[model samples]
Target: MSSTDTIVHILPPLTNQAQVDETYKSKNVTINTQEVTDRPVLRRDNTGLRNFLADSQDNQNVGYDGEVDTLRRLGRFYNWILTFSVVTRYAFYILPVATLLAIPLSIFATIHKESNIKGIKMMGLFVWLEIVWSSLWIAKLCSKTLPRAFRLCCGVISAGTRKHSLMIKALEVPLSIVFWVIACWASIPVIAAFNPETDVTVLGSNVHWIRSLQKGFLASVPVACVFLVEKVVIEFITVNYHRTQFSARIQESKRRMHLFELLYEASTILFAPYCPKFADDDYIINTSLLSTVGKEIQNVTDLQTGTPIRIFDNLGRLGTGVTSVFGNIVSEVTGGQRVDSKSPHAVVSWALERRPASEALARRVFNSLVSEGNDALYQKDIERVLGPDNHHEAEEIFHALDKDANGDVSLEEMTMIVIELGEGRRAMTKSLHDVDRAIKALDRILMCVVLVGAGLIYGTFFSDNFFKNMSLYTTSLMSFSFAFAGTVQEFTGSCIFLFVKHPYDVGDRVEINNVDLVVEHISLLYTVFRRVDSQRKVQIPNIVNNGNWIENISRSQAMSEHFALAISAATTFEEIENLTEELKEFVLADENRRDYKSDIDVEVANVGDMSKLELKINLGYKSNWSNEKLRVARRSKFMCALLATLRKVQINAPGGGDVAIGDASRPAYSVSVSDEEAKISRMKYLDEKESNKYVKDKGI
Candidate 1:
């Protein structure tokens, strides 16, 4: 392909401080998601199947209880069934076929040998050789279905990985026959002598080979040590770190796979960033050196639903609620310490808080509150759990626990509240920041160990390893292998990027070269960020980020945003100050007090071209800019108020001027706005529109 035809992808540049003001002044941006619900529900004619068939299950026989019993029964005898199948397969399929195939090959061997072959010697070697050569072909009876299933699950991925050699494949059957004849003859004459059986004859001579000659394969001992050494080293990491991530990925998929599949169907490009795949421990352990069996699933259901566990009672006791914004709702978390109200670790601490002193009593109470699914609890449930006598307190608790202002207390909220009834506020003295740092440190150490191990193996076994003569070549090979490791790309940048000049960490809202992004994940090699504008994942290598300027909005002490506007030069400085005063009063209102600070800085920036004035304004938000929704909302609210204030002050924006010829000035501008009157008229118009002129819009 020519360079001119090559497609290059570029990240979208975000509207900057200057650009955003221009856009808003011209009223260019349409209504965005920030003003709407997180995700709007689009109504359409029901195209879905009825629940009776889609969720169909026979209550009497196919219930969870019965399904569990059935699985238990099958699991108990599964190993026995597998063992018997393998035995019967070799007895019924392999031996009979190998015997029949060996008949003609034995005849060819004898014709070449000019002597009759012996029993248990010629047949035994032929069987072993036949099994070794034809085993992969025999497995094709089952493997034939694998490619189809793989393609179904992998989507576009299979085409790139699938290999083809048409010339070799065309001669497959004929070449198999020719190779089998030569292999069968050689097996009886040469490799046959190495078989376990004694008194084996070769070339019409009785020859029993010595044991050392038979075990010639042991010469490759040094190369075989790598696998054994790897196993030994891996145990240390397992014992310390545990198999948490792999198991967590599988478990987490139970709740997320359906969503991922829907996203994939919606847009493959958007879904590629969240590719979900799983590997089975059983197959990976000992299946085959080259291939193993696993499933690419279309339909997957959780085997079991997890119930809250007990945390404290001696019967052996079991187990809040601040929510970190946009945390568990997705899978990214920010904020510094787990002790913080909304962090997942705080939820853990709440669960383990030794409440009511009895595990059985706690379970009984929870069961009483929610008899069916222990997910959400309503006001009635709160009354039932706490009793009718403490109804007032129960109401307060219910309201407090309803974090999202949804009517009921969700399971997450229930699990997260930390209770402290009798003491003055003493800060939780501990934080889980060190815990995260420790895990990262351990992961880095493991990465180094794996890299060095791979380099040593490549140098010693694969490359030409000479103690003295080819020492330089071997050393260079090892160096190349080590340097080629994925994490090596981060080596120079990581030290300074993380410790010395660190701009951001995971979950930070940042700006890199004017592109606003939220840090979703940080790895040794690259950082994954989601564009605040488009919500698409962007992977920037650490080495690349090291060369760019980064602004960490989340870490900054103060949070503010500024925008510029071009207003009609006819407006006096007194009118501008009056507009600024209107904004100040708007910020100070009780309803707006929660989200905004009183630090409103509105000023005339410049007298531009004698036709218009440049006005720049900066407003401080109450919270850090980490919450994208709130930041967008606050900016939107302020902008609307600013426009209203400008209208009230008769300050015309620069674009509506009319051409004047001597005394023939044609005034092309008219402005009239009253917030109270507009609200009343808008509500009335909406009611009339819904009653008569409503047009249902489907997203198409």
Candidate 2:
């Protein structure tokens, strides 16, 4: 290859910066920031009732610090929340100033143009709004501190109340604001009536203005209800999205697995004590050198008296594992579950172990892309390697790497897209892609409902103009919506399939209409599929699946397939019994026990040809049939074992081959040109048999 054509994905030597970066990196990773991001993986579930009550990080992309994990799930947050931060920056400063100006203008106003809102009444409204706004901003600024201070003062920081504080934090600010508003409202009339309505002209004239202030504050009462609804919605999101038991379990599992891996890494380091400690932190204290010095001191102590220093025994145990003091410290520190990620054990393991593993993984990923050299990889090459069953993933990876949209993908492009394909594949199995979309979307949908419902409530019971016009517009809109309902029937059906039925999710292998297909993507109306037979992307409405029988292979466990064969009638019943014994033995073996269930059913299913007897077999796989490689291997091994057993039993085929096998009507297996000589011999025999079957059958 020319120098310009060389791959750009060379792994630079590890440095201090790379080491620092590795310390913070989690094993669960994602690819292109624009396409796929590392959203929290959650188990699929339905929990509407629970959704009515919490905002939790379990379902949200929250970090150890309890902040939204913007580094990972920013896509969902930005897309779902309607943000005009940029637009508001220039316009926001005028709002409070404009309201204050209105208050001053209201003092001279007495005109009412077809409305009850006179200048004095408007003045009351402005004062009321300003007070409420002031209270709200104050509450926001003290929200976190108030919750913490309350919990601290109440002595509720123990493990039992750790989870309870989440709810307290959610309620404290809103409740405090509501209490202050009611206080201002109730105390208003008292202030106006103070000094017994003194005969002094100043005090008597002020009574009218005090009454205006009361009405203004009274108008602000409904704001409390808004806060209440906001609290409820946050709780609802907790139950349904971030803190659902389903999502919580997944997150806990990730943390537990991480802890286990960290423990193992620490154990490995301690097991090999001879390895020199390279860490400056450990060396600064002279922990390793202390042990070495202690060993030498004990050996050479008191040379004139020829006595060893007994203190060396105590010093030697300082950093070394024994009943393992150091090991216990490492485990205790590593196992310590805190909101912070800076565990001492983790730091040691990352510096010594995981960094290398991470680097090795990166090199493997790069090598997979450039192994053929430069830009030799193409769309066809990926499809061929992944196989037709995985055509969907192949297409995704190929398209992601092929930045120019050229037919082929180059080495440089692969540098961007290849990251944790295994983890991504696993994420799909747990319905992560579907669940993540729902986490960000379900709240938005619910919020729209909350808003519309709130509007109707206000318009009907609160507003004179809205009450008169709302009923007519609501009915009119309802009528108009129904008229177009047929156009969105598919969408409605899709919602049912997703939020209700949920038979299969993205990356699930499903069988529809006898064709096995892998789900590539799901939209509201249609689902995209890639056929196992290499057919192109097929887009079908999800509604169609409801009416059809969908064999969800990914979700189903311990799946089995049928095997049938015809044997010559001359082959004794004893031979069939011998074949059953062999099949039983294959499944029961120590190595095969994990692969196949012991209940192997073998029976003479039919005698369709009269001259032959049909042997039917069913072997159940012991696990989920999702791993195609393992499934194929199990079937292939069983078939070979069965065929070898048939030969030992001296069984003959119905069509005259000495060994009984699959029916003659079935397509004969052929070896390719590049196949091994053993397979070629079988192919040669099959060809010769076909050529002289008539003569062989007649004993010519």
Compare the candidates by lDDT and give the number of the best one. 2
Clashing pairs in 2: 51-236, 53-235, 54-235, 54-238, 58-242, 59-242, 60-242
Stretches of model 2 off by over 4 angstroms after superposition: 1-130, 138-259, 270-434, 454-458, 461-471, 487-496, 505-507, 519-542, 546-548, 588-594, 655-700
lDDT of 1: 0.47
Q: Model 2 has how many clashing residue pairs?
A: 7
Per-residue CA lDDT of model 2 for 1-700, tens digit only, reads 5211121112222333333224223422110001011233242132221221122213455222322233235654543343445335323544656577565546524453112232224434445455555545445546556667666766644645544567667676666666666656654533323244322131223445554555545544555656567766655555444344246646644443343233323333343211233222222111221222223442324445544332322222232323244345656877843321123333232222222323332233333433355444576665655568867666765655453444554433332222223333354445665555654454465566557765666454445688678678979889899777875676567666765676777777888999888888766566789887786799888788768889899768568878989888787777778878887887887566656777888888888868899988988875565656666787899888888888887777886754345657654587557558879889999999898766545664
For candidate 1, the per-residue lDDT at 138 reads 43
What's every prediction's RMSD, in angstroms? 27.1, 20.5
How do the residues 429-494 of candidate 1 rate in per-residue lDDT, one tens digit apiece? 111132235345645665566566545554544435334546686677788887567565566466
- Worst lDDT 10-window in candidate 1: 310-319
TM-score of each: 0.35, 0.49
Among the numbered candidates, top TM-score falls to 2
Q: lDDT of each prediction vs. the true structure?
A: 0.47, 0.52
